[model samples]
Target chain A: MHALQQKIREEGIVLSEQVLKVDAFLNHQIDPQLMHAIGAEFARRFEGTGVTKIVTLEASGIAPAVMTGLIMGVPVIFARKHASLTLTEHLLVAEVYSFTKQHNSMVAISPRHLGADDHVLIIDDFLANGRAAQALISIIQQAGATLAGLGIVIEKSFQAGRAELDAQGYRVESLARVSSLASGRVTFLD
Target chain B: MHALQQKIREEGIVLSEQVLKVDAFLNHQIDPQLMHAIGAEFARRFEGTGVTKIVTLEASGIAPAVMTGLIMGVPVIFARKHASLTLTEHLLVAEVYSFTKQHNSMVAISPRHLGADDHVLIIDDFLANGRAAQALISIIQQAGATLAGLGIVIEKSFQAGRAELDAQGYRVESLARVSSLASGRVTFLD
Candidate 1:
């Protein structure tokens, strides 16, 4: 966790009051060592939670999720942002709005992957408005699966994502939480 | 590689004469153990190549690429399919035609990730008409990086992908090579 917070301070580029880009290490270009550490940390936090699957959104979330799955010795099911031709048996679909992309898209999961017997741990790169996490939670519930917990790499606590998710009775764990992203500076939450 | 072949024979679904869906274990819902084996197989194949980075296209390619990067103790950089807000520095873009999606999309990689001094191993889930491989090659060439090799989980040898890439002087290694996929039957090339 220290490595992550340190890396964010060193390599993370804050372009605006609302955006913190850790593209140098976390997303886009990834450091596998850091990813493994992040995964290990997540596993440590949610070790005996009876997690059956590591579920995440596609693209950015795939890396940490896969890494966590590897470390936890579980399977990772990434909900597709776009339903491809092969993903015809999409059992559950939830619409999510992305602050980064500035658009809403339907995220779906195949029934073959998740079911009532499974307990899922949600993983993502960042938590801003918590739209992505909410979508995954929706899919998990729709499949009759249990939401073990949510693991996020970075959480912009200045936003209401954590409060909103907590109010809804979902437990969320983030490696780094930012209390404020004001004046292009990242202030960590104590 | 044998386990991969066995997994294909067992879980892989041949939908059409040209389509083989291994979504059960390869893509959508991933088996991390199998992925680690696939990564280890790739690492074995490209052991002495001095691959500085594992490069891939996002959404599906992240798992195997990340696994390989972890095993090889290197970094992984996946090209972004869509340019998000933070992906403003898309230094290089390549047009890749998806045979499954039936459309061409621009794949971009940040220049900060790859350079002339880096040695890259291209990893992907499938290789059919070689369009994705070609696009990655173009991106690599643009960045002036060295291509160590191409590691594919499955290759449709019946298609022209291998031929095209071979003609272009790129070394490729596929775990399972399907010689044919006719009438929902998968025939592998010995």
Candidate 2:
């Protein structure tokens, strides 16, 4: 966690008044060593939760989710943002709105991959408005699976994402939580 | 490679006469143990290439690329298929046509992530028509980076992907190469 926090301090860039860009190391260009460490940390945090599968959204979340799955020795299932021709017919689908992209998109998973017997841990790179996480949770619920917990790499605490998810009764854990970003400076939540 | 071949034999589904769906363990729902094994195999194969970074396209490619990067102790930079607020201004972009989706999409990477000194190993889930791989190669060339090799999980030998890449003088290695998938039966190339 300290390592992630340090990386955030060193590499994270503040854009405008609200956006924190971590594409240099976390999203676009990934630091695999740091990813492995973060995965191990998540595995350690959720040590005995009986997690059967790791769920995440496509694109950014795949790396850390796969890393966590590798460390925890569980299967990682990512919801596809777009339904390709190869996608299965029976699927659990949920619509999510992206504040960054300003578009509504559907994330889907094969019904055959998740079921009532599975316990899922949702992972993502960033937790902003919590729309993406909620969408994944919806898919998990539709599949009748247990929600072990949610693991996020970087969370914007100033946003209502945490409160919204907490109100929904989902336990959320984030490596780094930013309380505020003022004048290009980040303040962490105590 | 035997382990991968066995996995393909067991879980892979023949969706159509041309489509082989391994979504259960490869792309949609990932088996982390098998991914690690595949990553280790890739690392072993590209042992002395001095690969400074692992390059991959997003969504499906992120998992295996990150896994290989972790094993090789290098950074993994994935090309973005969709535009986002976090993407940098200057980028290396390429257009690739998807055989599965039946559409052409642009993939981009921040120029800051790649450079002339970097030797990159391009990783992907499938190599069908070689369009995606060709796009990636174009991006690397634009950055003046060295192409160490290309690593693919599954190669459709019946297609012209391998031949096109080989014609371009790029070294490609796939764990499983399918010679044919006619009538829902998969035959591996020797």
* DockQ of each model vs. true complex: 0.86, 0.89
> Can you write out model 2's per-residue Cα lDDT over A17-132, one digit (the tens) per residue?
67999988888999988988989999999999999999998888888898899989999999999888989497899999998888999999998999999999999999989999
Q: Model 1: C-alpha RMSD to truth?
A: 1.1
As a whole number from 0 to 100, the lDDT of residue A91 in candidate 2 is: 81
Off by over 4 Å in 1: none
Over the stretch A1-190, how does candidate 1's per-residue lDDT look in tens digits? 7889999999998989999998888778888889889999999999999999999988888889888998899999999988888878646999999888889999999988899999999999999999999899999999999999899999999898899999999889999999888988889996
Model number with the top DockQ: 2
> lDDT at A17 for candidate 1?
90
lDDT of 1 by residue, B19-136 (tens): 9998898779988889889999999999998999989988788889988998999989998887888888647999999889999999999988899999999999999999998999
Model 2: per-residue Cα lDDT over B22-82, one tens digit each: 9988889999889899899999999998999999998888888988999999999999986
